[model samples]
Target chain A: MTRFALTVEFDGRPFMGWQRQSHGPSVQQALEDAVHAVTGERTAVHAAGRTDAGVHGLAMRAHVDIAKAIAPFRLMEAINARVRPAPVAVLDCVEVAPDWHARFSCIRRSYEYRIVNRRAPLTHEAGLAWQVPQPLDEAGMADAAARLVGRHDFTTFRSAHCQADSPVRTLDLLSVERVRDRLFIRAAARSFLHHQVRSMVGCLALVGMGRWSPDDVEVALHARDRAQLGLNAPSDGLFFVRADYPDEG
Target chain B: MTRFALTVEFDGRPFMGWQRQSHGPSVQQALEDAVHAVTGERTAVHAAGRTDAGVHGLAMRAHVDIAKAIAPFRLMEAINARVRPAPVAVLDCVEVAPDWHARFSCIRRSYEYRIVNRRAPLTHEAGLAWQVPQPLDEAGMADAAARLVGRHDFTTFRSAHCQADSPVRTLDLLSVERVRDRLFIRAAARSFLHHQVRSMVGCLALVGMGRWSPDDVEVALHARDRAQLGLNAPSDGLFFVRADYPDEG
Candidate 1:
């Protein structure tokens, strides 16, 4: 058996998220079915991050074990062809060591949240971005983002369905930048709890709109209660940017 | 009575183009319907450029005449609210002079063509960009583009169905730039023949792929026959970027 690593990109508008679900279609099911069609093996596809519904993936990493003797390039092309009509693409594929894991062996993961700060209704970016009609003070949002870039018990920002053992995680980066009416918030960490990125972005948006202060973000972090959370941004704008492994170079 | 100039944006996936059609919906019809709903007036909306089906509009300039006594901001807001679910938006609106025209009074029109040079099938950009699987030499395309930047009879590039009286047009700018896997071809002119931009991009793409040399573009131009056209690209990648009007800024 050969373990192959795959880089995937998908539009999250139609699926129920990255994981397999009984109720709705998912990215995982699409990839697994494509693999089955190509090699006649029902191999399981494991991804570095299991993104939520309506959350896009630019270059999410994943892995699958196949016993068939197929080349990486040919397998990639077959999967891309079979995954058709669905808005998913296997961007890159390569053989990897069997011991390597897509989720556990990952070193870091990064996400980006896109906000179109405009009053007019969205045209081309309707489902691709979050539309905030009010004017945003990006500097204020940046200041608030700075307060959340460290190790903390982020119970207030996590989802109640989180399966992680601990609420403590170290955030490597949290930064906000605005170009014209578009705002982008970027976050990076070794791992994130359920809904952590969206929850943090929601409170920072309130700060950008003058509804919350930077100190208020810090206060919420210390509160450690889900009820104190300011907001939970919608899943439309969140994107799983990339995952980094140790031997990426 | 007042003449209002509107800066419009739209996704062209659903419409038959900018002009009102008998069979399918159009951006003009959407704006006109919204205006009638808000003011009970059957106003005609004239656009600076009549884009073909599947061609998007970023900041299309259009004008409408309304007899209702309404503020420009209120009209804009109401029209935006009523034009819901159509993927069209009035980005800006203001009162203009009686003689001002969206089409006749326009000084310059600019367009952008997006090409994604990759082997994988597109995910998020499925209908938004044209995908070229082969590698492209953008510099070669740029060299070919430079040869078409002057006044000449552009019969080879004009579509046979074009309604323009003359085939002669002076292209002000035609440049190619590549950023990673995305290649953008930007064209600006006082005016253009129907399908001229798409035809030029098609031939330039041929040049980029080494099928046609830079001198071949000059040969095709001098041929002065539509049969000399190498290709006519799909309408999916064409975008009506903006129109420049000569007036007090």
Candidate 2:
């Protein structure tokens, strides 16, 4: 058997997130089915991050084991041919060492949240952005986001049903910037709790609208209480941007 | 009575085109109906350009006449509220002189065509961009585009059913630039013949793929026959970006 790593890009609007679920179709199921169609093996595919429904991915990494020895580019083409009409694309595939686990071997993951701040309803960015009718103060959002960077127990910013063993995670970067009518919040870390990025964006949104202050974000982090946090931002704007590996030179 | 000039944006996936048509819904009809719903007057709305079906608009200028004396911003809000669920937006509205016409008063119009030059099927940009699986040499496309600049009888590039009286329109600018996975072809002119931009893009695409030389473009233009040109590019990638008006400032 040969182990292969693939980079994927998908619009997560139609599926039920990344994991294989008995309830509905998913990115994982789609990939697995495509692999079966290509190589006649029902190989399991594992991704670096299991993104939620309505999220998007620019470059997601995954690994799967197959019996056939095929060229990486050919495998990419065959899998893409099988996953047709679905909003998923296998961008690139490469032969990898057997020990490279997509989930565990990843060193870093990055996500981006897009918000279109304008009075008019979004047309082109309908499902791709979180629309805020009122203009947002991006500088204020950035100021609030700065308070959440570095190592901290992000309990208040995590999902209530988060299954992580601990709430402490080191946030490498958190940035907020405005471009034209869109406000982008980009965050990077080794790993994240369920709904952490969305939760943090929701709190920063309140700060952007003057409903909350930078001090309030610090207070929420100190509280370490889920109830102290703002609402979870919708999954529409979130994107799994990239996953980094140690040997990715 | 007050005349309002509005800048509009829309996703043209559902509509027939920019003009009102009896067969199906149109962007013009939607906006006119929305205006009528708000002002209780059936008003005729005129746009700077009549984009084809499945094309998008980043900033389209239009003019509407209403007898009611209403604030421009409030009028925009009311019309937007009335046009519920349509992927159309009124970005800005201002009261203009009654003599101001959306089409006749425009000095220049700009358009952009986006092609995602990649092998994978598009996910986030599924409906918004044309997916070209083959790699395109952007520099080659730009060099070919330069040959089409300036005043020339563009009979080979004009649509066979073009309604324009003359084929001698001067192209102010035509540029091809690459930004990440997207290839943007921006064009500006005082006006265009029907299908002119799409036809030009289609021909340049051949140059981008190294199938046609820059000299071929000049030869095709000199031929002055529509049959000598390439096929019209897909409507999905074309966007009516903006209209220039001297009086707006």
**Model 1: how far is A108 from its true place, Å?**
0.6
Candidate 1 on A1-249: residue-level lDDT in tens? 999999999999999999999999999999999999999999899999999999999999999999999999999999999999889999899999999999999999999999999889998888889999889999999999999999999999999999999999999999999998899999999999999999999999999999999999999999999999999999999999999999987
The Cα error of candidate 1 at residue A64, in Å, is 0.6
- Over the stretch B44-119, how does candidate 2's per-residue lDDT look in tens digits? 9999999988989999999999999899999999988988788899999999998999999999999999999999
> Taking chain A of candidate 1, what TM-score results?
0.99
Which regions of candidate 2 deviate over 4 angstroms? none
lDDT of each: 0.95, 0.92
DockQ of candidate 1 compared with the true complex: 0.90
- Residue-pair clash count for candidate 1: 0
Predicted candidate 1 versus true structure: per-residue lDDT over B58-161, tens digit per residue: 99999999999999999999999999889999989999999999999998999999999989988888878999999999999999999999998999999999
Clash totals for all candidate models: 0, 0
Evaluated against the true structure, the overall lDDT of model 2 is: 0.92
